[model samples]
Target: MTERQILLVKNSWSYVIVKSEEAGQLFYHRLFEIAPELKSLFKSEPKGQSRKLINMVTLMVSKLQKLDEIQGEIKSLATRHHKYGVDPAYYRIVGAAFLWTLQQGLKDKWNEELEEAWVDMYAVISNAMIKNQQAVAA
Candidate 1:
């Protein structure tokens, strides 16, 4: 993607940054709706897990444009996620929930380009996460 496209994606995500709480809520709600089984990974209560879920997303969104700068942190996060039983497939589910939440939350503001941006961002983030897990396993 061109720098303009990158900027577009970053700008679109900027809107999400302002509404981080709502965005995280939407993401976790959609995630649990799709994968109720994963709920067992969280504690008996959902509040703490929910906070963690949202906080992670919020951090990811805040750093989306600076992937290289935060690679180490992302790797650490991926490792922690693994300890919680998160696998690559769980990344897919999280991505789906993330995109769905953005689309539903943003409504008309979302378009093909924005969708592509989000997809690309998720790919980069998830790949780094998976790679980190693989490295640890190796």
Candidate 2:
């Protein structure tokens, strides 16, 4: 991603962190609404799960420019997710939910440029996770 794209994601995320709890609730609500089956994959209480979601997102957004530095961590996350029965196809479902949540959270701030940057970032992250999943399956 370009420096501008990275900045856009980081700046937008700053607002998201202000209402982190609500954002996490919105994300899970959207995710379950779109893919109810995914709810089964999460075993923790909603409150704890929400915190985990926010923390994970925080890490990703903060490391946007230095994703390579977290490649091993991302891979480890993917491996754990695979054990939780997370299918590769679920990445798209999660991405859609995430984008929707961001749009709702950002309201008027959501725009084509921001959306494009987020979509690209999601793809990059998902690709890394999927690669790790595939390696584990092999």
Number of the predicted model whose TM-score against the real structure is largest: 2
Tens digits of per-residue lDDT, candidate 1, 39-63, equal 7776645556656765665577666
Highest-lDDT candidate? 2
Report the error of model 2 at residue 102, Å.
0.3
Q: What does candidate 2's lDDT look like per residue over 1-138, in tens digits?
A: 899999999999999899999999999999999899999999998879999988987899999989988988899999999899899999999999999999999999999999999999899999999999989888
In candidate 1 the C-alpha lDDT for residue 32 amounts to 85
Candidate 2, poorest ten consecutive residues by summed lDDT: 65-74
The residue pairs that clash in candidate 2, if any, are: none
- Candidate 2 Cα outliers beyond 4 Å, as residue runs: none
RMSD to native, candidate 1: 2.3
lDDT of each: 0.76, 0.93
